[model samples]
Target: MNYEAVIFDLDGTLIDSMWVWEQIDIEFLQKKGYVIDEAAINQIEGAGFTETAEFFKKHFNLAMSVEEIKETWREMAIKMYVERVDLKNGAKEFLEFLKAHNVKMAIATSNGREIVEAILEKHDIAKFFETVVTSCDVEKGKPHPFVYLKTAEILEVAPSRCLVFEDVPNGIIAGKNAGMTVFGIEDAQREDAKRRAKDLCDRWVMDYNEVIDILKE
Candidate 1:
């Protein structure tokens, strides 16, 4: 596909930060005297931090407000995202290729702005993206198409001319629903990510190298 712009989902797509969330969930639940379960994780899979906190409150009957819960999670995960999270294989090279080709780049992420900016700045790749649009910026998150569409609009790129790179099913659906081509990045953190990518995306790749090759063609 001939693409004029590239939009990326931060966690699991450009950065390997999914593990940080998994650990946060585990630690949070253990502290609350609850055990982590697949069902609980699934419930929050595609949700943003605020949405996830809402789920936690209702599921656990917690006394904390949504803001408090979100703040707690941010406190738990921000340091890790900044200090430990690193770019996925070939991510930096691909970003450089897009920059060299003058292809506009932006980030559409469900992650909070604090951590996203921290990780990107820490890796010195924040300069590559013209802007970062978080779920907090939109009323709805992925699978709704609002976030992706907003990113395309902000970048002044037509949805048809944009190519979205995502690792999760909701994000894949969001890109396609917004009338853009979506490429799936393999993320081992989500057990079904590869299968879902093949099922929902316009293209699927194990890493950014495969995507670079596709763009080179």
Candidate 2:
């Protein structure tokens, strides 16, 4: 592999939380006397809090600040992280391999820092990532390269020499825009996830085990 550092996406890529948003988003909409279409929620999957919250506020015509909307998600996510989140298959093993190879690793997430830190600490995976950046820390979320570029820059690695592991099209685009390699993770439950991911990603994998295979090459 021609890479010195790896950047990762947190949500669907590192943990399983696709349907978790449905409960919060739907309940919030219902509380606002609005009905949320399943399709709309599906489309919002993998989006950052700001992006998703903005969509909800605008599309649903909800009277709430983006921060407030994001807070709801954060609150729910922290609970889920403590009570629900589990590492994606082979995630730990892959991390161990990266550590063994002395590969530099960082996380660039669409999720807020609070939520990200909770999961990392809960799973005891904080040590695996040398640095962490959230959308809240940057001007824009995925599909904008600021966070990804920042990760590469902070790690002192050239864009072309970094590989980004993402499960969504937005993050994939961001990685590619930064001239870095993008590897899309596939979740079998979300069939369309792969198709959407391939639209922008350079490579695809079913799981972190597949990543191990790629690194071996």
TM-score of each: 0.95, 0.89
The per-candidate count of clashes, in order, stands at 0, 0
- Candidate 1: global Cα-lDDT? 0.86
Cα lDDT over the full model 2: 0.82
lDDT of 2 by residue, 64-131 (tens): 89888888778877897789778899999999988898889999987788988889888999999989
Identify the runs in model 2 with alpha carbons over 4 angstroms from their true place. Answer: 38-47, 188-190
Residues 59-170 of candidate 1: C-alpha lDDT, one tens digit per residue: 9888889899889988888878877888999999999989999999999988888888778778999899999998778887877788888999999999999999998888
Clashing residue pairs in candidate 1 (N, C-alpha, C atoms within 3 angstroms): none
Query: lDDT for each of the candidates?
Result: 0.86, 0.82
Can you tell me which runs of candidate 1 are displaced by over 4 Å?
Answer: none
